[model samples]
Target: MSDMTIGKVAQAVGVGVETIRFYERRGLIEQPLRPKSGGYRVYPDETVQRVQFIRRAQHLGFSLREIAELLSLRASHGTDAIEVRQRATAKLQDVDHKIERLRHIRRGLMALLDRCPGQGPLRCCSIIDALEHDQRLASEPAERKEPDMQTVRLTIKGMHCDGCAEIVRHVLEQQPGVKGCSVSHENGEAKVAVDTSQTSGERLAEAVQGAGYSASLVTEAG
Candidate 1:
């Protein structure tokens, strides 16, 4: 087998040099020892195949931990095809759940879009009106306000598009005591201003979860 430089190996495998280093760090692939007069570490052709295996496993929704297990199975003399198939089956179920959730989200957005006129004053647009109303309601003062409002940011996963962000913002803003809310699918986060006495970071997370997204508090404002 021909020896290859790190860059050459990465190029051959359609991965970056940093990815190769990361794989080495993750113990997914063994790094060859540097020669005494070496300017860079060299790898055997087998390393390219190993990196490709990692990439394919990732595309199949396997986490690095699971991929490591798969690699272990491959290295063992008594590898079980049934065990690998079981993992893949579980991954398929996860993907199915995600697809179902996405379909529900799509239906909701489509309903909203259907109600929209598609051409009108921004203020009169159905989608814009709904969003604006949510914002206005959220910003309205509570029956008793002592300025205990605080800001909180939460990282939300599964927001696949801008419409998902809008849905998340709308849902969060509807929560009692929310003063304002903003969500960004691109950033995968939601920022909310709420009356801590009437609501809380935990409640905000619950609202986000109800909206069909996984959420964790990123920052809590005092």
Candidate 2:
């Protein structure tokens, strides 16, 4: 490959000229040498391939700094497999976390939609009421007290919004043995007071799943 102009390299990589210049400024890609005759800035053919590499990395969620490190590794002839594998592993973990969070968000939206009548007045809309409050607006006072109440900490998943907390609370409170429930979507936790003799933590988790969410026992008071 011989000398190529910056515009030519950008066109070859399907990127704008400014993008290449920006990468150069970020030290992600090298700037070509200035022409001795002062015609136009020309780059080597290899720069096109490097720009493509950077763009591909960006598409995969690598920050410019990480891409720079990757480029450095690419340039080094003695790059170790372990270093590359570690970066790949870390990226995979990040992607998995993101997928989990999105799944939670989707489930919360579905739960809300399931409660929505979609044809009623805004005041009667269950989804609207859920969003406007942290707890269920229709909760009734406990009719009776339990002789032996247990406190359980549940790790609640599929709670990506404040409304999700409300939904979880509503689900648990509707159960026969449940005294009350408090939930925090941000922390993905629900603390419930229940009649231990009548209901178990697994039952509570099952109820949460019935409400279109996930729950697991973190701790239970005997």
- Error at 80, model 1, angstroms: 2.1
Error of 2 at 88 (Å): 0.4
Which residue pairs clash within candidate 1?
A: none
lDDT of each: 0.79, 0.79
Q: Tell me the TM-score of model 2.
A: 0.58
Query: What TM-score goes with each of the models?
Result: 0.56, 0.58
lDDT of 2 at 104: 64
> What are the per-residue Cα lDDT tens digits for candidate 1 across 1-222?
588999999889888899999999999999988889968888888898999999999998889999999999889987545456545655665677777666666766776788888886887788877676663222222232244556677889999999999899889889887766778799898777666888888888998898789998875342
For candidate 1, the TM-score is 0.56
Candidate achieving the largest TM-score: 2
